[model samples]
Target: MISPTTIDQVFETARVEEVIGDFVQLKKAGSNFKGLSPFSDERSPSFMVSPVKQIWKDFSSGKGGNVVAFLMEHEHFTYPEAIKYLAKKYNIEVEETEQTNEQKEQQDERESLYLVSEFANSYFQKILHKTDQGKAIGLSYFKERGFTEDTIKKFDLGYSLDEWQAFTDEALKQGYKLEFLEKTGLTIVKEDKRFDRFKGRVMFPIKSMSGRVLGFGGRILINDKKAAKYVNSPESDIYHKSKVLYGIYHAKQSIAKEDNCYLVEGYTDVIQFHQTGIKNVVSSSGTALTPEQIRLINRLTKNITVLFDGDAAGMRASLRGIDLILEQGMNVKVCTFPEGEDPDSFAKQNTLEELSVYLIENAKDFIQFKASVLYEESKNDPIKKAETIRDIVNSISKIPDRIKKEIYIQECSKIMDISEEVLFSTLAQINKKDFKEADKQYKTEQRAFEVIKQQPVKKVDVQYVLERKIIEVLLLYGNRTEGFEDLILKENDKGQLILEPVINRAKVFEKIFLDLQDDEMEFTNPKFKTLYYTIIDTLNQNPEFQLKNFINSVDTDMANEITTILMEDERYALDDWERMHIFPKEKTQNVAQLVTETILSLRCFLIDQKVKEVQQKTIENKNNVNKSVLEEVKDYSGLKMLLSRKLNRAL
Candidate 1:
């Protein structure tokens, strides 16, 4: 358990810009820093880091938080992990108290899997370096493949001993549980006996983007005909292969720095590329590419250059991945090495400069790559050529950006010697078919939700607007002192009613709270009601409450809402209105008026609702014409008139 003092120290010392800059590239934008959102694919900057507020907001994804929250959200770190990461970053020594037995026992299941995976990774690395068999076999294989000792260590390459029970026995002896070992696929338990899963294989530790070991991939070096050449960890609580990319932990920063990624098909391809000084590279780890994998890269950069071996299988894999990349709206380029060499062997055969030069010269846009590869296969067969042209058009249709699709379509038409009009017609037909299929599926699903159609959604317009405005005011200027004016009804000496004005000064939150209390008003929106009370409670406890401090204490949804409200203008600050000599007024400048108007508007809206309800009741029971019902309707109508008069609105 980390002490409160350490957490507070971490929060105090960590600067939002400095912390986020480690993951994102931030350029100065007025009082804040702006960059492309790390949470979404965007060509323009929408992520903002405010040093003053000590918070960051990615407008693209509607995610925002303080430094600790950002780490937790972006890196998927647990609370303790986020704190520890910050502490390590800022060189702040963490102060901890020992967890009780109960606390230790209550640790989450996913975290236990992470612990076991980490232990397995370390254990395998130790064996690779410390044991005779590991050094002779695993180290020899890697070294023989032209992998440097530094590269081997950097990627945490290792070797599992050939003996069936070697890893299982060692893990059990070290107090690591067998259940987690089996869950992480490091140990295989069978019929009251246990054995290591990756026995006699060279280990490749797979890490999450934050550098935590998620699982492992192992390769068998022996030439046994029956045994599979490669094995990967099974899907587990902590590792989902489809959601993770190999070398992403090491490649993320470089990917962002270079504004492009070199995607390959295997672990060695990624490692070799990194060793050759092209750090922005990741592999699908030999799995067929998935939309989830493309989105992972999409978060860092919009550009991907896929490297393929100059073989039929490699070209097929490249073709399979390109459509998925385009579906995610990423710009993809393709580069194939010379015949008889993969990324691993090719990088080894050439110097770093030669390898870099070859990649630059060989890279082709996806449209061109598709046309050229498919054209060669089609030869002069007109029918086969037509099919190839349709295939290329289908890939172009997957792209969501209209301008990018148009440009690619033009290029494809020229390369395939097809008319531009014909390609456009084919694309429209494909899109129309897709839409019809989607609509049919949607209608089928809608039938299952027939109950929802029975009760139509009612619009709570006035209450929603008024409640949200109140919350925005409290979040923005709740602590500031402001002067407020109130209108009161008074009797003159002649017993005539006259309006009187009274003025007072108080904190904005206090003024608003008192006004609501005087009117006996409350927010009708449940979320708004909850936020209102929370803000009031927080301000009562700490008069100096800040937005960042409040945000840090709330749950993610509430924090995002607060950030969205606060950053609404900053999102459009790129317009630079001040430079045009058209300075916008700050909300705080008229805080008291805004607060008073919001409360009065809510009150008037409520009275209007009451008037309508009473009138409906009167109509429903008009045959009886009860005096009490008439009086109720009259009273509500009069109240609405009085409130409307106070608001200076026409009745």
Candidate 2:
């Protein structure tokens, strides 16, 4: 029940680029920004943002919208959640009006989970700073790890007490429902008893791309051998651990700025790097990196620098993630720390400048990293070495970029002491196998869909004709002097009267639409009724309704439709090209220019026809009309006279 005024404030202050750039890395493309499409798999960027219009369009997926619309599309955020997120970002105060119980019940489940998670975040943070147990345990743990007060607070780090019901009791005291607490994995319920799940653990809160708290990761301080060293909140409506990357919310801006992200293994590693001023860092929290997580980082930066411990097992686990990153078309570099150290310890041992230098000097491309590591594992047996080279080439072939693949192939051949042609042949074989399997899967899905009687998808970008007609009318009549047109009807003697055109744009549209009613003129695609009404209503509201604003405001389907039409009929580029060629025509420059004059004359003829209408109307309304109408008539007459002079000169 947020007030309309509060909602409007959130919407008005929420910049589309700021919101989208959190999840997608955008670089300047002409007047707009472009990034890889979040909705599909691709190597090249197809997402576009226009700051002038405050809208974004994903050309690959055909989705476009304002900030709110993007949240809805990408995160499946409800309208209220999207607004509240923007409010939190921009620091706008939300004023909610009271809602009835039934009305409150109608709120979406995911939104409630978000609210519960947010409440849990505040609860954990409060425990860390305010409660004795939290202060002694979580705060002490982070401090012992060499985290400064500002660093801890900046990341919203917190602690949960060792008491069984400490967090659950406080959450319940604050009127948070046990059901939702359990749903968000903040509380564990067993056989009619409930308790805090993160007791005795130092808290590391996980955040959404927009920086909203979604869940937490916690580490144990006790020496219980039976207990896991670290535990994280289970998957919930708001948090999907496999799909989440810790510190991404905090590091997105820096990652985008640097055009790279530094991947680490744990929460402390991320914090230590940030403390050292290497800000573009995130962690998978020691789990196997999923494609979903890789895609999330891919949205922020194409290049990833994986900093893993130099242990053998660590290198093997990381190699698996490397292939996943390559499959997503991301550029990956590996930076292994010393055998005895992790990122947290290593970063703590060095200053920011030293760490930066170490990273720069040690980083290796994926192929080299893979070949070097696997070659060591293979112990230089020529047969095993050859197999290792093929394995490395397989990873290289997964990369979608042709240039990158070629470069890696050359590097791999040199490293393995093999022929480049042989490696290329191996890569080609792997690529063919991958594509055949992919095509087979696609055909299987198509067959299944056919059995379900699903209709085949019609071709995309095929309905330019209808869109062109709409644009044609808008350009011709947007600001014209418009009035209602009268049509003839049968009289008593079966006589008829003439029809007249309308001066009002809305009325002209209405007349045109009515005339086309029996013709059943189709727009060639289905649209939501509300969106259709919105477009029509906007055109009806403004006498000078520019097609650009309306077109930009709608979804991608309509915007693409309008842009295609506007660009299709206008040969402005060629027109200028021909105009510039005037003197090059040998001794026939006059004839070349005369043809251009003919088109200009026809344009004037159309304008003069409208000018005569206004002039006739001016005479009829001489005594009753406003003075502005007379001025408009004079302007039109002068324009017509100028055109007439041009016509005479050309003749």
Candidate 3:
């Protein structure tokens, strides 16, 4: 547990952008910072962070939260751990209280994983420096690759001994837990057997932004054709390869300072570039460029100069990467090394100044470079030439900025000797077809929960729909304090009792809770019932409700459920609402009315359901129709009519 004062101090000190920027790459999008989602693999940035509100929302994953929540979700930190992390980040002293057993367990598990990883890193480093095999094989191999001792130590490079159980046995003898070692992928355990996962390999420690060792990437030294050349840490609580960049930990500052990032394809490319005093560089670790990796660079810089190996396959890979970058609306320039040279080898051969000049001279805009290379290959065949033109046009269409797209189109027309109008037509068709496909996918996805519209009345499951509506209302408006009109009996001028409207102040949750209790109504669905009470309890406890904080605090499933309900009504909401001269009324404008109407509709539904039940009972006892059953049907019918009238609906 953490003291409230420390929590408040942490919140006040930690900037949301500064904290989240350490993880996901964020670029300014209007008033908010938008980037690729760390929670999911996405090309376009669906993850948004609002500096003003100090909150973040990942539309792709339906996760939203305050800064603390972001840490909790992204780092898998416990609430107290997240608070402490921020406190440490901001240099705030923490005042603690005793934590529950659950917190202790969670904290212990995650901390151990990190501890074991760091220990493994140190142990491997010791072997590299102290042992005979480490020196003769690993040290010599690095020297041959042109890496100096200082460079080797700076990057925390290490060597794993050839024997399988040597590393595992040493780890356990040091009092480290085998569970954590296996969890961090330093060791593999199966059916009471344990062995080092990276035996006889050179180890590369993968680190988080703040420089904590998360996992490792190891390269095999021996000439065993059966084994993979490189093996990465498997996905675990601490490490996700897709969400990490190879040299981000080292290059973040330089990338931000230079306002440009040099992207390469291998670890050596990144290390060699840094050794040459060119620090704004990272690698995809032999994996194809991912949106997550691109956004990691996007956080520090918008401009990416992709350094491609001078080979046929590298050119093809470059083409694929360019399209993904364009889709992210980034300024991308492609630079290929001379024939038979790669970024690693090229950097080793040239001085920093020489390499920098070469990059500047050789760099070309994606459109021009793509057109020139793609055209040369297809110029002989007219049919292939036509396909190449479309391919270039397709990449241009990926640019999110209309101006950029148009400029690229004009450039393409000149290079291809085609008219701008024809190019524009091709771009429009590609965009329209893409739009239709997206729309169709969206419509298909919407079928699971579309408000029960277009269904027969008898098949509608009206009770379930009404129950969902109640939960939605509570989640959206529960904390809103408003003046609600209540009818009270009053003596008029004639001294006769009469119904008069009275204004009373109450929270929306209070009104709904009281009304539901008054009628002994409850949600039928087990999930909805639990969720309803959770929302009501949460709202009741906090008079000033913070939706993002609440969403971040709850479990993932609950947060997702709440977000789904909140986002559903806005499913049809057009972003061009003002441009289209259309505006929908805000639910906030009438919180009291919305609550009243939702409750009234629920009562009416329940009453109608009761009436049908009674009528069914009467039919079952047709020979001697129960008098009480007839009155029951009549009473339910009259209640339904009255409720419908109150709702301004025909009975």
Candidate 4:
């Protein structure tokens, strides 16, 4: 468990903008920061960060919270993991109480896998720098490849020893369960024996975007004809190769800053580029590019520059990737190095200045590169040329933006000596075919959804609105002091009863609590009831209660609810309603009135429910002609009328 002081310090030291900015590219919008929703695929900005409030809200997905809550929602982190992430980010010392043996044994499987991966990363690094055998082979190999000591350390490169049980024995002796080790694919267990998976290989720790060591990619040092050169960690609870990109953790900031990403292949390609002063680059770890990986890059920028090897095979291999990039609505450019060299070798051979200039001058837009490359193969055959033109037109049709598609069409027309009219007509046919297929899929899904909707569902709670309103008022204006007026029935000096209006100043929370108690009202929703009491307790315990602090103390679900309520109001504030001549009334001005009205409305609703119950009873007993039941129904109906009158509603 993390110490309360450390958690509080994390909340105080971490800024919402700075923390969220690491994941989403936020641009300044008035006093707050706005960005495309990281939680959804959006063109316009719906994710807003409020520095003043230390919270964020994704208007698209309706997920909102403070710094820790954002991490828990976005990164799928537990409470302590989120806190530790922030502590590491801000360089704050984390003070955690040691877990007991029972607590350690109860850790979840996924967290255990993560711990094993992290431990493996540390162990491999220790072997690389501290041991003689590691330095003689793994460290020397990196040095021979032109990797500097700083580059190797920055990327956390390491070497696994040659012995089969070298890693497995150490990990098992260190109290890591063999089950997690086998699950993470770090240890391969047979009938009765276990061995290290990446033995005698140089290790590259593959990290998630948040910089957690998800897994590793190891390159075998010794040259053997029968063995594969590189092997990667298998899919596990913490790592998915299809969904991860090598060096994304290191490249994300630069990708956002430069507003572009240089997509390469292999781990060394990414590291070499970063070492050569090109920091905004990531690799697919030698696997074919995937839509999941493309979306990962799409979260940061819409521009991707794919760096390909100069060989013909490399060029041909990358054509499908270009189409994939186009399909994601990204502006893709291709940069091929000199003949016989890849990004890793090319970067190692040239100075940063030369390589940088070459990339800028030689980079060609995807359409142009595709045309030029295909023209060479089709120059002799008219049939092949026509097919190439059709292929290019098909690629152009995949672009989502109409303006960009038109622009690409015009460029393709110029390059292929074809008319824009013909290209546009071809694009229209492709789009029509696409639309028909998409419409077919939509109908199929709609039919399924309609069938599901026919099933009976419990009716939504009608008291939800009033309950939510009560919570919202407390969250927004709970700490503000307001004057409340109440009617008191008192005995006068002449021994006659008289109603006197008394005014008193009290916090909004105090006023709402007293008003609800007077009517014996309670929240209907279980979650809302818990939240209401938690807020009241927080306000009572600390006179200077802050919503952000209160948010940090609650669990993830309740915190998200509180932030949603608090941010629902701020969403309109972001619209700057005052400038639009829409002067909204402040709730604080009539806190007492709002509280009384809300409580009265709830009472009226409850009375109406009771009257309906009695009316139902009277109907059920109608055949028997029960006089007492009819009289009870009449009394409940009259009570409902009085409650309605209190709310100024006509019965």
Q: Which has the greatest lDDT?
A: 4
Better of 2 and 4 by lDDT: 4
Per TM-score, the best of the predicted structures is: 4
Pairs of residues at least 3 apart in sequence or in different chains that clash in candidate 3 = none
269-332: candidate 2 lDDT, tens digit per residue: 9999999899999999878899989988888888999998979877886788898998888889
Candidate 1 segments exceeding 4 Å error: 13-76, 98-104, 349-352, 425-436, 442-454, 461-468, 488-503, 522-534, 554-586, 606-642
Provide the global lDDT of candidate 3 against the true structure. 0.82
Tens digits of per-residue lDDT for model 4, 107-182: 8888788788889999999999999999999999999988999999999999999999999999877888899999
Q: Which residues of candidate 4, in runs, are more than 4 Å off? A: 27-50, 57-64, 97-105, 452-460, 483-504, 568-597, 610-651
Residue 59, candidate 1: Cα error in Å is: 9.3
Every candidate's lDDT: 0.86, 0.75, 0.82, 0.87
Better of 2 and 4 by TM-score: 4
lDDT for 498 (candidate 3): 64
State how far residue 130 of model 3 sits from its true place (Å).
Answer: 9.1
